[model samples]
Target: MKKFAVIALTEGGAQTARCLQEQLATQGFKVEVILPQRLAREREIYYRKGDFNSTMHRLFREYNCVVCIMATGIVVRALTGVVVDKTVDPAVIVMDEKARHVISMLSGHVGGANEWTRLIARLMEAEPVITTATDTEKVQALDVLTKKVNGWYPNFKENTKKINRRLAEGKAVELFIEPYLEKYVEQFNGFTLIRDIESHRGGTPLVIVSDHTGFAKNADIIHVVPQLNVLGVGCRKDVPIAMMQTAFTEFCQQHQLLWQSIVKVASIDVKKHEAAIQYLAKTLNADLEFYTAKELQKVSQKYPESAFVLKTVGVGNVACAAADYASGEQNVTQRYANHEITMALSRLHEI
Candidate 1:
């Protein structure tokens, strides 16, 4: 479950914190209210108390989100030494004691502070202070879209800020949409759609919305990879986690696929307890789906027939059938095999 911490200082802050905590709890968040020792003890408020700086820092590290019901300056001071990269840091929001305005103080976009700010503001009947340039200027934010589509930004190291800034400045940006996403082209307001690569119009930042990762690299190119790929695996019992990681990485590299594009991992139901495959799925943060031998047998005809595999595991090809079934698509990559595992990749087409 996602955890949230609500920190309050004064009496008004405490009251507001309680109200916000109740609302968040209803939305399936594990929330806790942290107040000062004196106020908590005297008022018998059910909360954690003492060491404001330490408590806030701990919550920042452990929680998915943190709402500080106090002065913005106090929240800033407490977070002075705890702030980190926006991508990995928890979303931080600050609300005044009266709760008239909710400010998205840290990790606004990718970390979800902007969205949370609006939700909390609505609950408190407060105005949300969204100051992100792309949002205020009505430009779509690529990072936020990435989150919504289960997509990833591989070239985010240098171009994240640059792309958003250029969009906000009204500079033209071109996009190449894959066939699966063609129907949603109208959702993007400021991009010129490219029909093909051969036309090659130059001089603008390019955004490629596709499931493949084989695009040529350019300083201005941003790849928005949707998580519509699935991986199927058949591994020897007791293989180590390192070997699984190496094999998966090699499979992605060989196919020119992004590791983040794999949304799920699948295998024969018997292998569900295999630690190596389980570890790989956990590492990828992908869903692990298992198929019975009967289910695998049904799809085996669509893939390469492996007589030995069928005799041993009751399925013609574990990796191919598993991936094909999980993706609900017939298009799959050729089997990639290592010493202890056989893997296959499949792409999904969204209607």
Candidate 2:
């Protein structure tokens, strides 16, 4: 569920925050209200006047979205010390005590401030203010689109601005996406689809959606890496994290896969608490899934089997079986094995 923090500096603003809290709660959002000590009521967090900046920083760190029911200048000043890059910052929305206007103050696209601004404006019957160049010009923001598609920009800080600026100026940007993601073509507005990046001429902004790294050498090209690969691992008891990391890195290099494309790590249910497996999942920033031996045994018959593995884990293959089961397919795309670890790779066509 989405978490929201509503901050109010005065009694009237506290009332507004309470109303928003109720409405947002009914819509399945977790909302908390922060008010000044003099204005805070029951069930509200209170802070002193001198702690405004510190409080704002704390809220930004704790909440997914922050609604400041106060002057825009005050909100801006308090946030200047806490705000980070657009990719990691929380959405910040500012509104007057009277609820006349709801402005998307920071992280407009990647952090979903514009989306929250529209929702809050509709709830309070206020004017929504969004000033992002792409939004103002009615053009699609690549950063926002990437988030929606479960993708990340490899060159976010530099190439995103270059491409978004060209889009805001009403210029056509060329897009070359992997065939597996062709179903999402409708989302790419104001972009020309090119069959091959190799055939494209220079000068037009280009965006490539693929899992392969180093597909393009141009500094201007933006690479949107989709989360489409799953890694399955099985290791001996008490394996070192360094060995796991080395194996994972080598596997990615051998397969020509980007680490960002790995969406999940799968392992046998018995190894769910294994530190090496957990470390691998955390390092890849992917979800972890554990399958039972019975579930894996059903698919393990097709792959190569080891007698020692069967005696130890009740299944001939752990990595390939778990990967195939988690991917909802019977085929394992790649497989690797060492003395202490076994690994498998699977590609997911749909997110």
Which candidate achieves the best TM-score against the true structure? 2
Those runs of model 2 whose alpha carbons end farther than 4 Å from true positions after fitting are 98-100, 123-125, 182-186, 236-255, 272-311, 314-317, 320-342, 345-351
N/CA/C clash count, model 1: 0
Name every residue pair that clashes in candidate 1.
none
Tens-digit per-residue lDDT, 123-224, candidate 1: 889999999998898777777766656677775746677777877888888878777655433466556678776554677788888876768877667888
Model 1: residue 313 alpha-carbon error in angstroms: 6.5
Query: Global lDDT of each model?
Result: 0.82, 0.85
Give the per-residue lDDT of model 2 (tens digit) for 1-351.
Answer: 789999998888998999889988878899999999888877678999799899999999999999999998998888886787888999999989888999999899888999889999898899999999998988777887677557887657777788889889889898888886666434776677899878676887788888887686776577888776778899999889988888887887877888998899999999998999998999888999999999999889979989998999999999998888888665545678764888888766455
Number of backbone-clashing residue pairs for each candidate, in the order shown: 0, 0
